[model samples]
Target: MPLVALVVAALAIGFEQLIQWKYGPMGIIAFIALTIGLKAKNTAISGLGAIILVMLLAQSN
Candidate 1:
């Protein structure tokens, strides 16, 4: 159980860093928009999240 917990925690940290690197700075904005869209079931907000995420990715490359 302890070993599993350690692995899970490490995986979580790795995923967090991966997302940060993948999203760059606007990751926070996209995350917020995604959360709002999910909670409110709003397509417009979801679209905004997609747009923001795409824009950030495009800028990176």
Candidate 2:
């Protein structure tokens, strides 16, 4: 679980960089791949939840 979380975190950071580079769709693709590859429901859910939170926070700001 911890390893999965760490990998997800790394991927998330990479996705964020991809988004910053204007490859937003690729970021989503990467996210989906990460989620599916991990094969952990909690990891996938937390990853999506974090993405949502970041999007919401960015929109609000």
Candidate 3:
């Protein structure tokens, strides 16, 4: 269980780093908004963040 958790954490960190490298501060901001919105149980904010992230990723490719 602990090893699984560790692997998940590591993968998450790596993805965050990849986003940071590819998209810079806007990526971080969108991620934070998504996380906070989810934690707060607000669909509107989370949706906005998700949209921003999707747009950013789409824009790149």
Looking at model 3, which ten-residue stretch has the lowest summed lDDT? 27-36
What's the CA error at residue 8 for candidate 1, in Å? 9.2
The candidate that wins on lDDT is 3
Each candidate's lDDT (Cα)?
0.79, 0.63, 0.90
Tens-place lDDT per residue, model 2, 1-59, is: 99999999999788677654653554555555555646765676657645754664476
- Looking at candidate 1, the ten consecutive residues that score lowest on lDDT are 16-25
Model 2 has an lDDT value of: 0.63
Writing each residue's lDDT as its tens digit, candidate 3 over 1-61 gives 9999999999989988988899999997898788889999999889988998999999999
Work out the TM-score per prediction. Answer: 0.57, 0.36, 0.83
Which of the numbered candidates is closest to the native, going by highest TM-score?
A: 3
How well is each residue in 1-61 modelled by candidate 1, as lDDT tens digits?
9999999989967865776777765776686687689789999998898788788878879
**Is candidate 2 or 3 superior in lDDT?**
3
